[model samples]
Target: MRIIISPAKKMIVDTDSFPPEGLPAFLPRTERLLSALRSMSPAALQALWKCNDAIAALNVERLAAMDLSRSLTPAILSYEGIQYRYMAPTVFEQSQLDYIRTHLRILSGFYGLLRPFDGVTPYRLEMQAKLAVDGCRDLYAFWGGTLAEALAAETNLVVNLASKEYSKAVEPHLPASVRFLTCTFGEEKGGKILEKGTACKMARGQMVRWMAEHGIDRAEDLRNFDGLGYAFSPAHSTESNFVFLKGDT
Candidate 1:
């Protein structure tokens, strides 16, 4: 059955008021990456954080400096940068490396799902890319809305699939317009409202139109939609709705 939502305004999640528990297990490597980064000079790190070029340089530096071919952890770290660009790693010495690489590919491909390329500033994009590598599922969870919320110290909206029980619990509490976030047609190749010109066939114009009819303005307004999980703003009145009709055609 199709579902429609019409939130009067953007549904706000008082992130500070209702913070999530610790990060998920699927995100330990991400944690390690962040921890490792913390050891670097704050000034350098901040520069890197602010400059895309610096971030790219850091990524290149890490891969070149680390011996990924020798161990599982190193290989995983090395693959992190490669995956952000949606490129697969040429080397995989361990099963763990292979596993991590698989996830990275998903993230890179789903890059569009996080935000429209143009809307996400280069610095924010770089930050998200780095955050993706940090074994932080909460960041990965709906394009890291909570993570973003924490970082910006402000409330943020996230969209995810409704199939899970967790979504069910939150659905009723959300505003009517934003009940259903964006629909994910597929993985990696799915819909990413966050990224512009990065939409998949299933999440193309038709989906956007549907959102407009319900309430969604800029494509960037779409946080994430993987068919299974979704999140979006219930405020910013545009259109409110959910679910993709381009299924099993």
Candidate 2:
């Protein structure tokens, strides 16, 4: 089984935590993306990133000096979003780290797909970015079925903890033989499931950490997850989707 999640927008360079195991699987494609990003002017890049002047300037500087094959931080240690912060890989035990390294995958627009320890540089392309390349209109089109094929090659079961944008890269193109299970973290109110972005991010990260700590492999076992006030809702869950709701505690 493989667990797939989204890449965080905010990132940092942390060489001290752990050295990257190796380059990403799609280095050549990433090289092309780098070239295309390099060709864009700062104004255009800022537009693509959809950020304020300071954030855009920072990313612009990063893109200017970015190198795919040089000094790098492990992918799992680079992202600084709330989800990653909650996952807290930096303090993870060695066994938990090993478990995630074997099971977790990060879906990306810049690098395509990344293993937990894959060496990566900071950049600003999202899977849903509108940057067109060659004849492809967007990142999703460029990635196509590549991510799906790679995951299907590795395992027949996929646990999707990623948002719709990143997961679309794989889930839509997956073969029928592969079992794709999605986990939803939300609150049940007035007979409706409402998900707040920040809370869901926290839940996703906590869930990843919990799964790794327990070395969970089977999809059904995930129903036992009760991290961050969430409890599995059998009424809301189906064969392909697992719903966890946070009630008044």
- TM-scores of the candidates are 0.23, 0.98
Q: How would you encode candidate 1's per-residue C-alpha lDDT over 153-229 as one tens digit per residue?
A: 21124343222322332344444333234444332234333322233322432333333333443334344432323
Model 1 residue 2 CA deviation (Å) reads 21
Off by over 4 Å in 1: 1-145, 148-180, 186-241, 247-249
- Clash count, candidate 2: 0
Model 2 spans > 4 angstroms off:
none
TM-score for candidate 2, please give it. Answer: 0.98
Q: What is the lDDT, from 0 to 100, of the residue 245 in candidate 2?
A: 90
The window of 10 residues in a row where model 1 has the poorest summed lDDT is 115-124
Local accuracy of candidate 2 as per-residue lDDT tens digits, 1-249: 999999999888888877999999999999988899989999999899899999999998898888888889999998999999999999999999999989999999999999999999998899888989878999999999999999999999999999998988899999999999999999888888999999988999999999999999999899999999999999999989999998632
For candidate 2, the lDDT comes to: 0.92
Residue 228 lDDT in model 2?
91
C-alpha local distance difference test of each model: 0.30, 0.92
RMSD of 1: 18.2
